[model samples]
Structures are given as C-alpha cells and as structure tokens.
Target: MSTIPLLASQLVVTTIFNSIESLGFSNIAGKVFSGEQAEARQEANLKVNTKKFYARGLKSLEQQDLYGAIKNFTATINLNPQFAPAYNDRGLARYKLGYKQSAIEDLTTAIELNPYRAKYYSNRGFMLTRLKDYTAAIADYNSALLLKPNLAQAYFNRGSIRLQMENSLAALADFEAAIRLDRDLAKAYFNRGVTRYKLREVQGAFEDFQKAAGLFKQQGRMDYYQDALAKLRQLCY
Candidate 1:
C-alpha cells in the first residue's frame, strides 16, 4: 500500500539473497515473483505495516521534526496499539515539546508495556532525574541495568543520582563502570573527578578533570571546561 513495503522487501532480499540463490534459484528477485506463495507473502507483509508507520516516525525524528515524529508514531500506535517503540518515541517527542507530565505518563506506559526495554527505563530515568526524583531515577536506572547490564549511559545516570545524594563511593563505582563501557563520556569523567576531589583523592581528581576538560573542549562547551580547569588550578597550582 506504501513505499515502505518496497523498502522492506529490498532490505529482506539484501540480507538473504545468497541463501535464496543456493536453492536452485538464479536470483532472489526472480524466485520471489515466480509463484503464488511469494505473492501471498508480499501481500501479507504489505498489509502488516504498523512497523512502516514506526519507521516513518524514526525518519522524522532523524530530521529533528519532533512534532512530525510524534504524529507518525501516534499513527503507528493506533495501527497496532501494543507497539512499544512508538509509545517510547512519542513520549520523547512530548518531552521535547515540554509536556513534561504527559511525557512521564507515556514513558511510564511504555515501560509497563515492555519492561525489558532498557531505553524506555533509561529515558524515564532521565526525566525523573530532571524532576529531582533522584530516588525514583535510581530505581529506573537499576531496571535498565537489569535488562542491559553493559549499558554505559545507565551507569552514568545512576552515578549522577548517587553523586547528588552524596553517596560518593557508589557514584564512583557507577562512573567507573560507565568509563569502562565508554571512554568518551566527558560528563562521567567530570562528575567522577568532582567526587574524587571531595574524597581527597587529589591525583584521581586531577586525572578525571584533565580528561573531562579535553572532552568538553572537543564538544565546544568551553565554559564548563574553563571551570574544570579553574578547579584543577585550585587543586594543583
């Protein structure tokens, strides 16, 4: 019914052409159109296109049109009421539009619909973190970790929450895990550096600050980098 089916068919053929060719078929395209079975498969796939709406939403998100993405994602959810990603993306769109409470409800529903999705929990945790519900944010981050243990961002967010609570040891552990998973997280380095400074671990603090400063500079966030540098000077100069 839409161009999306064409895209999906192309994707499927691209991934499985070799196997199809080996089965006495000249090519996937030729074999795919040779019989009633193939025609029926295509018809079924074309009709089952809640995913196409979801894909359109993702494309809109990539274009930074949050409202457009929300519209498409909402359509996808209407097409298939149980689509978790559509709900998740719609929640994100609502958040960007400053509908904070609605975003929270949508994200919460997404988490309920698919508790195993780490991104849903992670996004909800971020919103909760901003809302100053550090306790709840920690719980959400913990849920994400349970689903995807190696998720570096979840550790970093959890670390931030622990840092806010002044639980420096726990925060440091999380930041360390985050750094292990992704070395490029400047915020992790900066926050960890601050925590180390509070703990009187001067060398550790200095190292973290230096790394964080470089990362900040790379990101063009020079003001914070300057602050970190000033702190470093106060620590060692």
Candidate 2:
C-alpha cells in the first residue's frame, strides 16, 4: 500500500539560566578608584545590566511580544556577546516573526557559543525542517539526541522527517521512542497511528487514534482532537 506522510512542525522552547551574577552598585556607589578598578566597576555594571535585559527578554517572550523580546535580547547580547541564551531566544523570536533565515543564523550562532545545549540543535533542526532541508534537519536532531538522550521532542521530530522521506519503519520506531519517553505527547501518538496505518496495522492505528483524540481533548487542542476522531472514523467504517 502506498502511504501518504503527515508531518508536524512545532518549535520547542528551552529555558536557560545566565551564569553571571548580578552585582549591585550599592557597594561602589560612593567609592570608586581609577585605572583597573574603574574598568572592573564598569564590567560589573555591564553584567548586572545584561542580566536585567535578559530577564526582560524572557518576560517579553512569555508575554508573546516577539518584537519586544527581540529588542531586549539584542540589548542583552550587546552587553554580553558570549551570552548564548540571548541569541537562542532572539532566534526563537525571529522564527516566530517569520524571519526564517535570520532565525537559523541566530540559532547557529547560539550553537557556536554553546555546543553543549541540546535544545539549540533541536530548534535549528525545526527551522531546517520547515525549509525542507530534511538531511540537515535529521543531522541536527541526531546531535540533539546524542547530547540529551531523553529528548522526546527530537525523536518525534526526527520521526516526522523520516515519515516524509518514506521511511515508515524508522518513523514508527522514532514515534514509539518519543511516546515511551513522554506519554503525554499527543502528537506522537497521532503520528504513530498514521505510521501504523501505513504499515497495515489497522488495529494499532485505531487504538492510537483513540488515544490521541483523548489526549488532544485533554490538552484543549480541538483541531487535533477532531483530526484524530476523523482518522478513527475512517478506520471504523
């Protein structure tokens, strides 16, 4: 049976903490020397300001203000060029605002700044997937999984890409791994159902669709719930 692939493209966010301590200026408000001491005080003030700007950027991101988030993150990066989280978040904001290539560049910069962050690779993989760069996207997902073995979203996304490539068995394995790692991953169940149906496992598909529909309803995702229900109906009749 020829199978049609359904892919999901949702960008996931990562929460990161800044390592720089916020040094309050109260201690040096009145007493400050020249030369190296003056330069030290200036550096301390910049770190504090960088923290504040980074916090504001995170707040704006939470409030769904993409432009505000970008502006604040840019300030944070200007204050501290090596701050990887700022670049990562700015990339997220750019991606949301439809600046896909710029988003990818920001993500790449973030990765260069901090290669240990698994989420950075996953995020860039998502942008690559949107651009239909399946091979590169898979490589990014592979890197993410290698860095963090329990990253369920990476598995789900890789499975989605594999499905698109007509590798249904590999897709099924990835979806299963994702579902095992995160039971609440409703989309994983839904996609696994699609994979199962393509593999002629009608009963498995029916069960998966039912589970996906229930989970989607619980998550308040009406569109996905309706789609799952529709798939179930097709299997039933």
Q: Quick one: best TM-score, which candidate?
A: 2
lDDT of 2 at 234: 94
Position 24, candidate 1: lDDT: 60
lDDT of 1 at 208: 94
Clashes of each: 0, 0
Give the CA lDDT, 0 to 100, for residue 47 in model 1: 48
lDDT of 1 by residue, 1-237 (tens): 555445877888876876666786666555656776878977677546887888889999889899999999888887777778888899898898888888889898898888889999999999988899999999999999999999999999999899989999999999999999999889899999989998989999999999999999999999989988987898877
Model 2, TM vs. native: 0.83
lDDT (C-alpha) at residue 70 in model 2:
99
RMSD (Cα, Å) for all candidates, in order, is 15.1, 22.3
lDDT of 2 by residue, 149-198 (tens): 99999999999999999999999999999999999999999999999999
TM-score against truth, every candidate = 0.77, 0.83
lDDT of 1: 0.89
